[model samples]
Target: MRDSFDPSASEIETTTAEEGKTRKRPRPGERRLQILQVLAEMLQNPKGERVTTAALAAKIQVSEAALYRHFASKAQMFEGLISFIEQTVFGLINQINQKEESGLAQARGILQMLLFFAEKNPGMTRVLLGDALLQEDDRLQERITQVLDRVETSLKQALRIAQTQGGTWANVSQDEVSIRAAMLMSYVLGRWHRFARSGFKKLPTEASDISLRILLSE
Candidate 1:
């Protein structure tokens, strides 16, 4: 522990010397959230580089061992970010259900939000789109794929909504809706790839409105 900000990790341990009760460690959820928060902060690096465990520990003001106490592996710490992505995007999808009257608009709005979110979170885009998760454990990219699938699913649902409300439901089933959703998702993924490859100096939303006009247009 450092002299000034070296907060004791022992206080939250399982077997305290005095208590000896083996009371369970305080909430794992909170610690997990902190880990994810630190991971997000690490992603904000402008260089678009991979974040290391040592660097992450330094950012959180905790030792790498402390980070391990909460997460078994670096991959696990990334899973926490994956979980946040799922929760956040889906939560917003649920909210879109309440706010938007037309499914087409909901689909459009959701994609817009995803693009905007990625713009704000450069590091997260690397992870979400597999730009950052690549070359690590294979499973990490799979999890990010799941994140994309979830987004595609949400968009498909919105398309289904549009069919019913926007008079675009012309004999479309969920499968057809899913096809269109997947295409839209692929477009966004390509944009993300270009932006990341361009050192993040290239904005993904450049010419976005015209593109969305063509995509969502009849």
Candidate 2:
């Protein structure tokens, strides 16, 4: 993936019928995406403060009222970012599960992909760590909890399959697999938290391969 996130032209057109004089106006639904992209970019700042609608509007050269046109409230805007994270990560996870034959390998790849994604998208890492969601609606944090649960479920499935295939942990029961999956989630969360708290200086992937080898080894 590209180092920074940018919306494709097809995804966001510059001209709309409302903005006359043939000037480029944001297309339908494009403004919402532009808003979300700008929000992500602002969150990338390691020392960034709690984002306000006024600041976000200033960044995009729009009035706060204009921002309200696309989203009912700032929390809704954040929900958009969280939704993107869920879709992107889970879609990639599905691919990993489908393509990889070795269950342990699938689990490993999912963890690596999580780190790699955070490394590329520093702003999103803030969201993953709950730094950006501070003081937001309680439900936003709940949504993150759900996302983590889904990740754990995926890990558990891969591990159970691995045991059945006699790759590793062949003698383990479902309960053990569940415990290991929880451990994997904890590992991922810890790495993400460190990355965010260190001003994005400490990478999630630092020493990750060796660590995962030890964690996944039987």
Candidate 3:
């Protein structure tokens, strides 16, 4: 399993030397990625202030007009981050489903993956919990909510598999499977919220093993 998220080497900026002078320029699509990367880093601030375009542009050493050249608006930049979150997460979920045979084990793996992702990416944690989007566009928050709902759906599928496999959850009803999935989703979100709210001092995976054992136990 991947332990951390990082941009590809190709996405990083590079410099070219010409005529005794070195000039740094981002490759095609690199500046757009750099913008998103800086934004995520700024969000790591524990203060949790709304990230403004001015601050973002200043951090990137680019004018506001330059940022607009890559992204039409601040919301589009956020959408870029959100898209990263969705792709990284769902891609992993598909992997877990493919490798894990037991349904309960799948659920456990998914939950652990989520916590680990948040613990590793503090800035993205705020994005996951919607704290970073509080004052931003309502559509941004809505998109996050949709991502969360999809996560819950994945959990439900795993629980349903466990329920059918004749084990501790063999007798669990369909409705009960749904309820359990929701509870697990809530737990994951609560951990993320605490981690972000505490200025990243509180790790999401702190004591998660014991907690998951209890949560997954009959």
Candidate 4:
């Protein structure tokens, strides 16, 4: 449940209270988005500490009850972030699958985008690496694992296509494709860790093209 500037979270309007005082409040859906945005911003910290609902409520300038008005609980807020990641990443994957022809190219593009997206959204990178969900509900971690598994499956599919099309591998079996896809996913995860651990100083895409070339060559 971590990431970047959401344009939609910008200040919308202020409403006058019954006492004739103007108070600022996020517009309807915007509050929910703002809550997620702040949660993500807090998670981007290099410490990778568990964020408590009290702290999250404080960050949003709202009472705990106010926070609950938008989300049932803190876990649900994390789920919101997870849902955002799944939709955003998979939507892009669908496009890559639709437009890309070469299996190798599809795999490469997916990996590159994975790193690029992380590089740009460091907070979300923390969630992707499970650094932000260490102490939260175990289910959040499982959801992240499932997302990565799907990514690996997509990679395996692309690799199998490459093998069928020829010029990608020499008699590589389906098991081997799974293995390599897992390895590629591992590499991406490692890069994400480095990016987060290095206080976001290290870019995930540093020499990424050359690195992918070497890895894919195997």
Candidate 5:
């Protein structure tokens, strides 16, 4: 029955975490977003040269120590980029799930989104393909692998439905449908990689309807 119950132990703990202690200020979630924005910008480079903390700091117009204030290490920054990639790509995939009536249409939408995402974010394409993550850390590459798996899984789901409807593909097993989905994903990645390597010149989906038909057929 004190003035404020002596600010209980839990309250004090929460206060310390919120306000920070001796090491450094807590990294705001928004700061993580900013760090990723900068990282994606770096990836747009065609040469895909190594991205150093110093260079990132310069691009962001902040000191390297400032970058560390939000991320523990440079590798964590790449992880941040991967997190954004997952959130964004999957969010679109979910929307297609809810919106599309035809499996073929959903498949088309997913491919369109993938290539369009690359076209919109040139720098992000480099990082997405691991041209930038190549020597940085193994974790970054693993994250990319997981991203591809999710996309492939979504594709298989849609294509399996398409086969059930007996359209372009008919009576496909999960295994065969899964293989076709993976192949489509591989095609998209190849297109994206070429776009990133060409410095965003070559597009992956200009005449994609015809190309997608070829993929859907074979």
Candidate 6:
């Protein structure tokens, strides 16, 4: 049950012999990871400018052609980052669901997990908020939207479960569940937006203890 994703873990190294001298090189598929890591790092820039393939290639000390060899286009690189965000986030959500029997506790765990993840991965926060997807492929934003919808669905399920368990929400209608779920989702998105817009100085988890208590209170 890992709590966060480590971008540095994606790095790989290998040795290659070039004319009798050994040099370090990235193994197959390692360059792709490196590219994503660098892109994420660049997105941490507060300027919020659209990242160009040329800029990405320069950051990694590779020609644009080399990048294309790994990723067909800039969109593909962003897709890679999105894939990482999805896998990490949903994986944790699944863990929270499996370990917690109380729906309210599960909801609290999920919300806290999201904030902690964003606090740790500032660049991924931009991706989750669609800030990094600006001016890029339309499908990228669509994918992010889908991810958010699923998160809201998860929250709804947790709230519904709580209601069924005869707690504060026991008499609540499904519409109420939906509304609460939407509110929770909006809160997370607002925190992420502020964290990114503030140059990552404002952590998503800042004051989360009191906030979560209020949000999850009966």
Candidate 1 global TM-score? 0.77
Show pairs that collide, candidate 5: 44-123
Q: Tell me the tens digit of each residue's lDDT in model 1 across 3-71.
A: 111124323456666756665555745565666766776676667678898998887667999889889
lDDT tens per residue, model 4, 1-218: 22345656566576678888676766678888888888888888877778888999998788999889999988899899889899888888888889899888899989998998898888899889888888788999999999999998988898988898876485888889889999999999999989998999999999999999999995
Tens digits of per-residue lDDT, candidate 6, 1-218, equal 55444567665554556766454777777788888889988888887887899999999989999999999888999999888888888999999999999999999999999999888888888889998898899999999999999999999999989998986779888888899999999999999989988888988989998998898777
Least accurate 10 contiguous residues by lDDT in model 4: 1-10
TM-score of each: 0.77, 0.90, 0.93, 0.91, 0.82, 0.92
Give one clash count per candidate, in the order shown.
1, 0, 0, 2, 1, 0
lDDT of 2 by residue, 1-218 (tens): 33345757324333546655344676787788889999998998888589888999999888999999999999999999998898899989988888899899999999999999999888988887788999999899989888888989999999988998974489888899999999998999899888887888999999999999999998
Q: Rate the local accuracy (lDDT) of all candidates.
A: 0.75, 0.87, 0.90, 0.86, 0.77, 0.87
lDDT of 1 at 71: 90
The root-mean-square deviation over C-alpha atoms between each candidate and the true structure, in angstroms, is 7.7, 3.3, 2.0, 2.8, 10.4, 2.2
Native-referenced Cα lDDT, model 1: 0.75
TM-score between model 3 and native: 0.93
List candidate 6 stretches off by more than 4 Å: 1-25
In candidate 3, where is summed lDDT lowest over 10 consecutive residues?
1-10
Can you give the lDDT of residue 94 in candidate 4?
82
The 10 consecutive residues of candidate 2 with the worst lDDT sum are 7-16
Candidate 5 residue lDDT tens string, 34-147: 667667767767777888999989976779998998889989888877776788888888888789988888998898888888787777787777777887889889888888
**Rank order (by TM-score, best first):** 3, 6, 4, 2, 5, 1
